[model samples]
Target: MRDCGRTRWWKGAVTIADIKSSIGELYAIEQLARGASAVHRLHPMAKLIATAFYIIAVASYGRYDAGGLMVYAFYPAVMMAVSETPCRFLLRRFLPALPFVLLAGISNVLFDTQTAFFIGPVGVSFGVLSLAVILIKAWLSVTVVLILAATTPMQDLACQLARLRIPAVLVMLVAMTYRYMGILSDEAHAMFTAYTLRAPKQKGIAMAHMGSFTGQLLLRSIGRAERVYAAMKCRGFHGAQRLAPARRAAAADWVFCVCVCLFSVLFRVVNFSYLLGRILV
Candidate 1:
């Protein structure tokens, strides 16, 4: 009985720790954006455009074509290394998007049994290839966006969106959402901490309490936002979000954007992986 009690507390600690860590991760990304790397200095609109084109190219690959898809990894890999973003941090952020991707990709393995190729004595099926392609694409897509977010401040990115003629309402909505995410996370973390302290022997809040638990978190966050809104308005804050003075994209920014997009398109059409495989043989 003592052992069981100790185990519950240990698990509860871990759960609370995870919530705290999530709050840290949100701030960490914003902190990294303050760096002065070449990638960081590129005009936000240019980076946004380049990232969009890269994602479109990545999504164009067919489900069964893992060979070509494998070669598209260079964009994220080079971007992270050049931008000096932490690979492990980016990988951790990549995980929350994985479960649904895994659910969909795993089905291919069971449903697709026709053999497409053989590695010596081992046979590989189209389903297996498709699954591999899906997982790789998910990682690539997530990492590329992370690269963009890690290097660009939210205000700058939001301003870029506004400049690009993204609807002002939509831009403001997105900016507010991004700004409030950290606040909400902090509120949730505090609630989680309170629960663990009061119920020290439980591994988590009781399943029956989960709805109320979540509701409480939502209510607290809404209240906090209301207070903050009132405080800001008292200080002569209107609805408009002011951004830094706009700077036009430089010659180098154009060169970098055009080069990356062109390479992405070229890579989409040519299977560099197949070429390398043949050369090795």
Candidate 2:
């Protein structure tokens, strides 16, 4: 019984470590992408506009229309390739969100069971087709978000959000959270490392001690937030977070937007599955 308890404790610790490591890696990648020269030339608001439009189109499409969703994949693929972001990086970032989408899709499969059409030897049921549509929508939406984040600096993105009538408080929270998340993550990692160094073989810390540890972390974070607020006040920060002067969109920005809008509309309106059926006959 004691051995089983010890194994479980270590398993929990390992899982925590894996989660932290993944977060740290993602943060590092974002920082690197933000510093890339190409990203500096792109207007942050343009990226924001493209992402917003992509998401809106995806949401407006019918849930059983897999053909529409598949056509939209080209948008992200083209953007990803042109931005020089590695396919591996985007896949790694996007895959973490897929399981939740799949789980939600399972319910759609169980509930909507009307037959839609036949493809090859397979009879496409409404349930399965709907599930596939949901998955594709989720995937494309996530890709758009990732591309936006990769291309735009966090501060710039926050500014764009603020301009777009997102609540000031929510924007501030997002901006501040992104700024301080790295610090908090580092602190958490140090604490975990110290704990492991001292108690590697111990089954687990006592419940009372665990509570105390959490309290300490919260107290430290509160203190840090206070200090940061004081620093901001000293720097002449008003109620609004003033950003650097905004830049006008370049010709490339207009061209990019027009192309994306055109392709997205064309794909959504043309039912590829129906076209394929006609071609086959």
Candidate 3:
């Protein structure tokens, strides 16, 4: 049992390839945003505004009202299909965010036992109900943001943020941080690979070395940032991001944004599923 456990742990350990692959995934999504398809062609501001409203609607639901959350899944499902995004890829990207959500949810399962409903003869409690709500909310929220990213170029999105009257420094911070993720990720990957090559059979960095290992990574990342900034300056990069030339939002863009926001607000107010079930029976 002990040997099997060790093997599983080793197998599950993250590698350089995994880290690089994540960077590749982000690059792929950014490329996807450049496509000429309908969803991609929508104004960045429209998509951004719609996404904000959708998130607000999703987050407004009560913890025990998981059924209403099911209806909200329509947005992500349709967005994935219409946007031509691979569901598996987005889900893989979401794995990191899932754990904390699950951790919070699982506590409700163990602690809150008040009866909430029944699945045929099986009784369900508020705990289980809340867990389902939390999971659905996380999935919906993440998917909405992913869809926004998949459809809107990062610079354009940043531009819309600026147009919305967000502070220039804050927008620059968001843009710069996002711009540096790929670089930092590559640095970390290289350090991890070099560490592994020297001690091939070690499961991971030793606890004793964790501080030094992370400090080295931080130092390299900072140096890389300095070099990047110098290159930017050489190219005449100002403190501002050069947004794409703004164009008038066509009528269709306004219609699309309004419809989506209206529908989201409608769903938040009405339990359409329950009403339909009642009328039919």
Candidate 4:
């Protein structure tokens, strides 16, 4: 019975080893749920166009335009709600980029000598207001990009880029890199799990071991890439991955695009405060 127990323990250990070995496949499974919303059904090119226009408008406007930046957020907020992307998930993802936004906003406080108004004893400096504008604009731009990425498959995005006259090589590189990132993430996770299981608790991983671990990962990745390439070649791959082109954009997609563009332009060009002052007069 003692011998049988030992054999069973070893068998369980081997099963974990097998799971770690196939970690890449596991990671790919996780990515399947990333952008599973109905927004994905919209035309990829239309999404790309709207994203590009939004970015340009935000970037081109004056950094002191707080009203403009506030208006810009309305579009993305509406889209997020309508697209069915979980707001909590989007917020979580956006948090990482917040620090950099704050850093840039700090510069506006330090510089820009223009004074805007006074809040009680505290004078409202144009510089500080500019900083707020920058942060808002940056947040809105990032949100749009995130939405585009979440909704569109990487392959479909690449195809859209290709149709937009972007270099084929660049499109291919982006497509392949995006596709393989999940694979590498899975591989790394599996390796770490296996190493943890085998190593003694008292002799935990050290910083010095990372170099060796990274080297091994690179070697394994290279080997896998070679096998994948060979398999593709065997199946008549001709330098580019083949995919069926997406269908034409429907009327609904065109309507969505037009509405977004018109609203964005109006938001940027029209000053509601000035209009309100005129109405009061």
- lDDT (Cα, 0-100) at 162 in candidate 1: 86
Residue ranges of candidate 4 with Cα displaced over 4 Å:
1-38, 112-115, 198-205, 273-281
Model 4 lDDT tens row, 1-281? 86556545555443333544444433332353255555677898888898888888788788677765666777778778766766766776677789998887887788876789888988888989888887778788888987787677677889988888888878888877666766776777677777877864413333457688788889989988898889989999888666678899999888877778777777678876466567998
Q: How much is the lDDT of residue 267 in candidate 4?
A: 66
Candidate 3 residue 221 C-alpha distance from true site, Å:
1.6
CA RMSD of all predictions: 2.9, 2.8, 2.7, 8.5
Candidate 1 achieves a global lDDT of 0.86
List candidate 3 segments past 4 Å from native: 1-11, 232-242
lDDT (CA) for every model shown?
Answer: 0.86, 0.77, 0.86, 0.73
- CA error at residue 191 for candidate 2, angstroms: 1.3
Q: Candidate 3, TM-score vs. the true structure?
A: 0.88
lDDT of 1 by residue, 1-281 (tens): 97687666666554645766786787799999988999999988889999999999999889988889877888888889989999999989988889988898888999998999999999999899898889988899899999999999988989999888888779988888778877777777788879878977677666667799888887887888799889989988797766677798899999999998999988987888899999999
**Which prediction has more favorable lDDT, 2 or 4?**
2
Q: lDDT per residue, candidate 2, 1-281, as tens digits?
A: 97677668666764435647777876766675575555445788777877788788888898777765776777788777777777788788878788998898898778887778899988878889888888888888988888777777787888888888898889999988877877877776777678767977654454446777677778889999999989989999777776566778898987777677766677767876578767998
Pairs clashing in candidate 1? Answer: none
Worst lDDT 10-window in candidate 4: 24-33
